[model samples]
Target: MPEVLIEAVQPGSPDTGAVAHYGDPVREQRTLEGAAGLVDRSHRGIIAIPGEDRLSWLHSLTTQHLTDLRPGEGSELLVLSPHGHVEHHAVLTDDGTTTWLDTEPGTAPALLDFLNRMRFLMRVEPADVTADWALLSLVGPEARIPGIELDPPKVAPVPGAKFASADVAPRPTTVYSTAPLPGGGWARRMAYGYDLLVPRSRVAAVADELAVPWAGIWAFEALRVAARRPRYRLETDHRTIPAEVGWTADAVHLDKGCYRGQETIARVHNLGRPPRRLVLLHLDGVSTDELPAPGTAVSTADGRDVGFVGTAVRHHELGMIALAIVKRNVGDDEQLRVGVSAAAIDIP
Candidate 1:
């Protein structure tokens, strides 16, 4: 498990869990409510691909349309095993000679090691930039910061909002536009390119000046669940494939040329159905006093193992809701029991 580092933003304020380096709960809530806030995601992996063959080298390894990615364009992609298991899902962006890969924190080292093993005398070089660059997430309504634009025009924008990036004080910055949610909620992230390290003493001052919110892992987990995003460790594992997690819409590119797991992805897309499907579960008659453990069996009224719960939360408005991976043939409106505790969950 990744250890969350807690940093205090204000004197006597609650210690915040910085998933990367700084966590702010107030900022996290603002992020969910569409308020402009910043989050430090620097702890997440940031890999730089430099040198002449950077683009070509990366294109050959990941499953996305990277060959034609423009200087300021970003796309999500997956690194897959030859047998079709998902190795890692990454956000790829290029800034001239170097391409930046933003991935989960703990997963970066292993990925870098794998890429290094496959270097094979290529001109490309891969290096970890987490320590050098600070990742700031600007999200919510009215979150635009001066000079950024969203990429796809069709995606809805929050009122008085646009996405942009800026240089980390005293450093160069690269900004790329991205899609915002419908009805005025969106997220924009900027990576401050630093030539020299910023002192840790001024970290909180920088964060405070930027208005970045402190978010804990719990708050982030809730936001991801609300967005219906599948996480790496909780909802996925070695046996999981990109298609099984419904990541094709964002991660995999079907028309792209041969890459690891391309055959399996194509075959599954064209000829086979996903054995299990992801679903939202709303628990009924449960209070703060009683909560079902994750991985507890979910069975049909007739007692068949339909699925198991993955994550659950107590919503301010919706009571308790969960995410579950269940057998595909299960009816959308079916009522199922979680564990032998008699707790019923309605498929939504």
Candidate 2:
């Protein structure tokens, strides 16, 4: 799905090259909170891995346990560098014959290259199908769209996927689903939603069928910050480990078999500490209406830099809040500063 296509479906003023909201961002946020809004995430990337050995092969490479992954079940996984830094993050669902991997934008090319090189004569093959498949999401509360029925447990694994064969790929009829994002840790926290993998050719039509107000990335980002969800690019740097952002809860299987970065994970876990910890900072709205920008310096009141802000946004109800990584020793009552505003830590 191209930016132009996204613009075409969007109902309001363009925030950038893409339309960020439909007239009022706060209204869209409210719509999403009621689970009556559609969010276009078509810019994200999607990959298709098809072969008899897809599950076991993915099990050996990623942090998630895919070996026993039941068909239609969704799991979040991470690819770590040799030194244990996060390299890629994906939420995937395997339908027996093929595993669909959904990842951040601009991630598919590199991920596809990495997978191709790692094949090593295995029966598994992976391809970038982002141009053919797009993603749409419905968030908040029970998060149900009118026409889509998502029942992962009842669907059995099968070999007749529409895109099973790489050479003769066809648009998939089945819409794969992911588990709801884990949500909590703040007031006015809305339940996170699930993702749907739909054909790119029909993305506009599918979104139209929902009959709900549309939300842009702005509303989604605000909600994500309030929910304490960590985005790979925003929350992670070159040296970030999964433990730093509490990603172990959803993305890492501590007891899983060896992968590229297992040693670092084990060392960090056994030592009982990571160098940094993720925290939520409530910026003082009275001092400044503006929130700290991503990568803005977050420091102790005395001016010692502790860490950088990952994401900062004004929630529809939570006021101004931001997610930052700070030294683990930063006390619960410590007052931090982001730019000109004083910040209070919201415990995760």
Candidate 3:
């Protein structure tokens, strides 16, 4: 696992005595598709935004159209700088009283400060709840997964997922917000999972409640890459425009009232192409044990630096795979290389 993935799942034994992959990545992926697989994603920063104005206030600032989000609805939102660079990508869920934000690690403090500064007497109160709330993810068949369905992420190409809708009573010890994820068929890339926003005190108990074999970051990273989902740190940064990464649909509501960086998104999406495009690299026969590092240069056959690789993984099914950003002008069939190994680019 790369450092980013290692840190995400490294809480290892301390969180719930969870084993990395239950001894087999293939079995874990199989169970994830056929039975159940649990992943501890609690390393993500958790922030609680509470108040009457929370939804409306957040709506005005982010790229998502959140003003009308009812309780139990989840949306992905991005906060952009004045110059329209991607500043924050948030996985947000609301339950009427409080809206929970799951962000990249070490990002909550700064994001909290930024949100607070924007709240000048509004009824919104944002609090860093990482110490109090932890995120646990459960995925598999609807019958095998413990809780009600999690919603399929909008704009996310966890594509063509048909989620189970039969309502079930919330768990006794832990309550899960509806995610409405699809069931079965990993090849569909339909995400079927639940993010248990359990109290930090109950993370262990919730892990037990799900009662599935623990999956390491390695297995989950392949799923995210195959689904074409982009993480905040690995796939984006201060220089990213949401549209450049094809996030306008899942993360941005182009018709929503103006907010920070809307202009850049609209301009690129309507009139111009994003300077770079997101690509999935199929590494040519690189050993799984020797994955390339992030920021490793990606080049054309002639060694022209078109872009750099982002998240590189040796996927269980896809072999050595990676997510990258490259110049839009790069041909679809253009063969590229990272380090000594050759790679093929599939731009999304």
Global lDDT of model 1: 0.59
Clash pairs for candidate 2: none
Tens digit of per-residue lDDT, candidate 3, span 293-316:
778889988989988877777666
Better of 1 and 3 by lDDT: 3
Could you give candidate 1's per-residue lDDT for residues 1-348 as a string of tens digits? 233454432221122325522334434554545655444555567778888887777778887656666554565678899998888877766656667777776678888998998899899889987666544454445555443355431111111112122211111112244433222222234221111112334456555554545544445455556556776655665767876677765666665568999988777776557677677677774434355656777899889898777776555455566777788788876768776444443433
- Candidates 1 and 2 compared: the better one by TM-score is 2
For residue 96, model 3's alpha carbon misses the true position, in angstroms, by 0.6
Best-to-worst order by TM-score is 2, 3, 1
Model 3 ranges with Cα > 4 A deviation: 1-22, 142-190, 286-289
Tens-digit lDDT track for model 2 on 229-332? 88887888898999899776567666566999989987887676899988889998887887666789999989999999998887889889999988889998
Best by lDDT: 2
Clashes within 3 Å, all models in order: 12, 0, 7
Instruction: Assess every candidate by TM-score.
Output: 0.74, 0.82, 0.82
Please state the error at residue 191 of candidate 1 in Å.
Answer: 17
* Model 2 regions more than 4 Å off: 1-18, 146-191
The local distance difference test score of each candidate is 0.59, 0.72, 0.69
Instruction: Give the Cα-based TM-score of candidate 2 against the true structure.
Output: 0.82
